[model samples]
Target: MSVEPLQRSAVAKDEQWNLQHIYATAKQWEDDYRRAGSLIDQVAGYKDRIDSASALLAFLEQEEELGFLYEKLFVYASLKLDEDTRVTEHQARVDRARSLGVKISSATSFFRPYLLSLDKQTLDGYIAQEQGLEYFKKELYDQFKYKPHVLSKDKEEVLSQLGEVISAPKTIFGMINNADIQFGEVTNEQGEKVALTRGMYMRILEGRDRERRREAFKAYYKPYVGLKNTIASTLAASVKNNVLFSRMRGYDSPLHRSLFADDVPVSLYDNLLQTTREHIAPLHRYMAYRKQKLNVDELRLYDLSVPLVDDCEVSIPYEQAYETMLAGLAPLGGEYLDILRKAKTAGWIDVREKQGKRSGAYCWGPYGTHPYVLLNYNDTLDSMFTLAHEMGHALHSYLSDANQPRISAQYKIFVAEVASTVNETLLIRHLLKETTDEPFRRYLLNHFIDTIKGTFFSQVMFAEFEKLVHERAMNGEALTADAFSEIYEALFTAYNGELVALDPEVKYGWSRIPHFYNAFYVYKYATGIASAVSIAGRILEGDEETTKAYMTFLKSGGSEPPLELLRGVGVDLLKPEPIRDLLSLFDDLVRQLEEL
Candidate 1:
């Protein structure tokens, strides 16, 4: 049943994350906000003086300082706003921080163009002349990779200043999804009408009561279906805006524009989509298996999430869940375990979901501070896995921050999910190995299947959807709610198989995803899992050499190109073997399920 969320003050102090470590009070946050604004104003001081190696070194140093301050300030504002999205005060802070960020971008837009203006020989000479440049050498040399995409200084400045405008679509959607939209209500267990929520929807969808699941399916989509047009507009604006930027940057497509940052090619994106579709038979078989196991004559989209082994739901209290997570992840050794323990006890994690808080879980932190995780924890098995997943990100961040310079500590999104996925893989494997119950063992196996489906199959389907919408927008086709539904439904049927029935709400799946606003990002989840499957397997087999290499990979951070970094740990995305291996295991698991 959906009860009103507790007020922020109602929650115990320790249950909430310690924002005090970032800033003691709102007053201090404002002070840093102002400090960042002042620094943004002075960013123009390094204008033409960056031509010389010594001057460039000085400019880089100042830029790094400003970056450190801006990141911390922005993170605070964003996290504070997430705590209570309805609060206009936090919203104002986020707005001011974003505006200051735009100013910084606009002011420093000249540096890249100037740096690219010099010949490689001259740039190398400058790097050699300045000993301090060693720290920034990789970042500096990496600028040449973007020589083709770098716009003129004037153009770049104008574009940089429009950061707020460019982000408007995402910002509007955030408000709609988090604060404004409501998921109507569903019938509770007692047959009393109760308000529905995202957390409730997740649990109910997986519930054994088919009617409750059906009721929730409609209630959950009630808002999105009702406001389809508005969400469609926001999403369209985001896609078209990406198209505009991609064209302006002279990239082949928006996909290329996004992958360009990590030095990935369009082929990798296309390969993920194609390969997943080709190997989608096992997913179809799993759906059929679900239909058989659940004894439902016709499987519906809502039926997809309910565990095949029904009546296996287990409640894991937060403390119990945390302890279980620690036990599951103990394979990573003591150092990792020590940090994980500290994260739970320290103010690093916001554990419970309350009113107006952000709905999802993620790990984030500013440099020189421990990483923070925001979880709308519902104390379910899924919630426990989420804990493991997000903490994976935290451990990665902690290692990177401690080992690398600030510039490299921020790893790219491509390699970012690997650490998180590895933790999840190891955790699930540990649970499976330790569990003695046969049905729960099968339930765990089902959970792992869902992970592959969600993280790999579903993501690739989304990657394809993203590609199609962008291509449509690129071709000057009209983007509407109906148009999006048509494309989404067809893909849904194609990837999911027609053996299952479709719900009207299924097509509107594109509307609810916050990730679509950030273009071409989900494919990395598919790539990440493929890599993690390999890394986790090796580690599980007592491969110390691989474990050491994996830890080093986490510490390496953004020092090298993401692909090269993955290659060091034996995950080469350019090769299809890893993806193929993952898919083959998935096929084997389905056969095992068939036997069971």
Candidate 2:
């Protein structure tokens, strides 16, 4: 079938997401769901056998089969959920997966607690006893890293059962953000009114008219401010969840627990925030230049996203954008490039905007299937950037799946953004160099500078806010909406001191950022972007060693901790060099824009 026909077939029902790709029909999905249900019963059979090394290994092999099936079922339901929030049937299917998740989790809870319960000698002996299970030794050894806090099986099962409830705060916040709350309309300076949707907010914020950007900022925040208390409570609840989990798991702090969940060190996160704080002067200086160029007397919060060069625009259709991105990423060589081309031809990308579709973009899929990307294409430079970002993730999954076992194919959240941001960095740098048109070059250069600012500096500022909120809550302080606003407002002043006017309403910025609900999540964006900038430079310089190491990082999957994974790829995030390099690049771009 032609691309047009396939596209129509995929989205024929106007469903939130296209699930037909997974099972071809709802009946097939039901059949798979029932198959998953049957597999749940078989898990109980393995419970008793888990104590014996030989029996446990056999059970693990059986469990992997179940896991593979469950992944398909789960991914199908999740993609459906992302496509449209209004699909009740898909919601029920998602709920089914969530509810069954507890069962599958409970069935496997004994594996870790039991392994840790065994003495190191016995565990090592078990590894020595069976060659078949030797490959899993690292997997077990990684679990034992949490040995100090490993709970008893019964307690672990209880935690597993409560997992859904434990994840409620994030779910509630997502529902509110994606399905419940709505921002009112804002009129641009030209008197053209636009609905202040989450997707359009950025477009308006980047408008040339200073007053329109300000109005958009206020109009966007208006609903969030009114609903501030509720959003604050939701965020507070999430923090409390992290705190409780950390305390219960014997971690030192919420941040430690969050980072430790994926084996990330606290030092890396701390270093990122501290380095960004020390370097805020550069960011502020850039912002000051932007204010002068935009000719705003007192640069307000709304003035932040506006481009200094107003008349320039970079617009490319989807196909041209793909080719441009492909050329930029050619350094990865034939194998990696071939995988991306397959992804493009395989209907792996859902690339157009439609009604009721979720805001933002993500690359998602389970094991045994190709990764899928969902994007709202707007034919702007930013839209092209989003495509690059999501494709980075899709390609990472593609490489990991092809290279690693299903058991370890999924990459952790910590290293997840590295791949995506690396693509964006490469794509932006290529655009800057390839396009000689002065106006477009300036626009691309300014856009690159803005990305570094937004993704690296601004996220670090937000991460600081995350750190403060968690620490404050730990110290017997309540995170009321007002209190949050106060803390975040002061942070804004510190972060953008001389650059822009930190409006009081900007205090509620914390309420608008969804990452805060995920606890210590936003920092990764900063660190990831920094690492990407560093890595992209190496690849562009045709450093074969760096390019090979970076591809190895992509293929490493969840086999190693995020820090070690990146370290293996030659970027030591503990030192502040990567971030400094990013800021320096931003400085260069700033000069280039000035020269233009």
Candidate 3:
């Protein structure tokens, strides 16, 4: 008899997230949903009337209340759906919530145009007259920064109405990736051919068996390769749509528009790409080291993932992983640890793999509730590091929510990866320091080196790929599947150096990245790691001032721009030093591994 993967229903109650924290029952969800619907009406009622200071304040307050209700409703529904995606009832709830979300967007689209309509003098006079505007003053004034980009009210509403249609490419790609794509089969331990899964694919990549790694790599890419043209069309449409909006909004380019919200300059993006390429030698040396250590004739892309240190695996249970993570992160101090500890038992984590559960992991929750993490914990060392990474995001959310008001509590996407990387950095450093076993020490170093390779180097490569594709599209070139593959292969060659041999499947890598649909978002992953290296290093060195600043940085949230927040935490990413230092550190780790 075939033993099926455990379904979510059979999972232990304690291993699940208590989504009831947001709603007691389906009835409560319906009540909130109806309330949000009425609130949409109430918010729309104040539309053109938000001319006076008092009227604006009242409108803002009402919108905030509606936002709070809407988030609770949407988040609960979405989380339930993710628990077991096959459930139609939960899917319907999410659809209802999303429908409500779209309405909310349509109703509020007028506010930005209206706010931008006022002259500085008029807005200042209004703020001066109303004490109630104090809470919203910063956010209010911040709208002026987008004055150049804000469309007229009619245009704004039209754009808002077209939001779903405009976002169809991303939605289509997501469905193709998550719901429809299929991988080929691989020979399992039982000598039977089993369909390859994402989890199994990653594990196989890290396995000692070269044949298995090669087989799994081909299997994983089989579906992507087959549907390459379809995926390419989706990505092209997404890019062109971004360029269209950028042109419509009077921005210089799509890249500029992405950075405009965070007040980031074009130079910052360009600098990261150029600087990494300048310092690419260390990565080349490391790639050569991988080839030498693996004793493979040619280091194929598939060969790059298996552990350099073999036969050094450790089985860490979930409970032990949590404890070790707490220990690794203890440098953040008792207060941070206290909250991390509480999250383990407080229904803030969904920590198991089950049939129909969402694949991969993320930290998500609406404001007014603790952050929830969805993890498929498989008792591996990587799983332990994942626990550290996600909880870092969780506490960042928790601290920010507790400290800032609803308007500013949500951090920008640019800084979202920093706190998580800091946790990963610290955890690896702690593990490195504690292990005296030469092989395990080398393994830790290799693991950390590979993390940097994936997170920092590869991301910069992807970012540059984005810039090139978007630039080509902006210049009126066709973004074909072959074009994407050529660009990606060249980048893969440049970034990974000439040491690794390319397989036919390597160029098609771009077809699998979900982030490409999001447009100019992956560059932050590189910047985030640079900042985290500095902050984690200081914290590990007992720099109390930096720790305090980082805590404050977490709490400040989107109240300030991401660059300024990193500056406060003692990392100026605009300068060449942070990236250079991170590269040098990567070099040092690789050299240490070579010595070991």
How does each model score on lDDT? 0.87, 0.79, 0.91
Q: Give lDDT tens digits, candidate 2, residues 1-596.
A: 01222233455333123456677887887887788778777766775466667876887776777788788888888888766667788789889988878888877755665667788887777778878787677777877778888777788878878978988888988898889887877885467776787767888777776666777787888888989999999899988888888888899999997787777778888888877777667677777787778776788888877777654555677888888889989987888788877777676887766555666788888777778898877677778788888999999998898889876788887788899888988888887778778888877777778778777778888888888888988887988998899998888888878566767678898887878877788888888888888899999999999999988988878887788888887788999898888878877777777777
- Candidate 2 TM-score, C-alpha based: 0.85
Give candidate 3 regions above 4 Å deviation: 1-20, 24-30, 80-92, 151-203, 215-237, 352-359, 476-486
Per residue, candidate 1 scores C-alpha lDDT tens digits across 438-507 of 8888887887888898888998889999999999999999999999999999999999898889887999
Sort all candidates by lDDT, best to worst: 3, 1, 2
Say which candidate scores most in TM-score: 3
Better of 1 and 3 by TM-score: 3
* Alpha-carbon lDDT of model 3: 0.91
Error of 1 at 368 (Å): 2.4
lDDT of 3 by residue, 214-248 (tens): 99999999999999999999999999999999999
The alpha-carbon root-mean-square deviation between model 1 and the true structure, to one decimal in Å, is 4.4
Note each model's CA RMSD in angstroms.
4.4, 4.5, 3.5
Task: Return whichever of 1 and 3 wins on lDDT.
Answer: 3
- Model 2 whole-model lDDT (C-alpha atoms): 0.79
Model 3 CA RMSD to the hidden true structure, in angstroms: 3.5
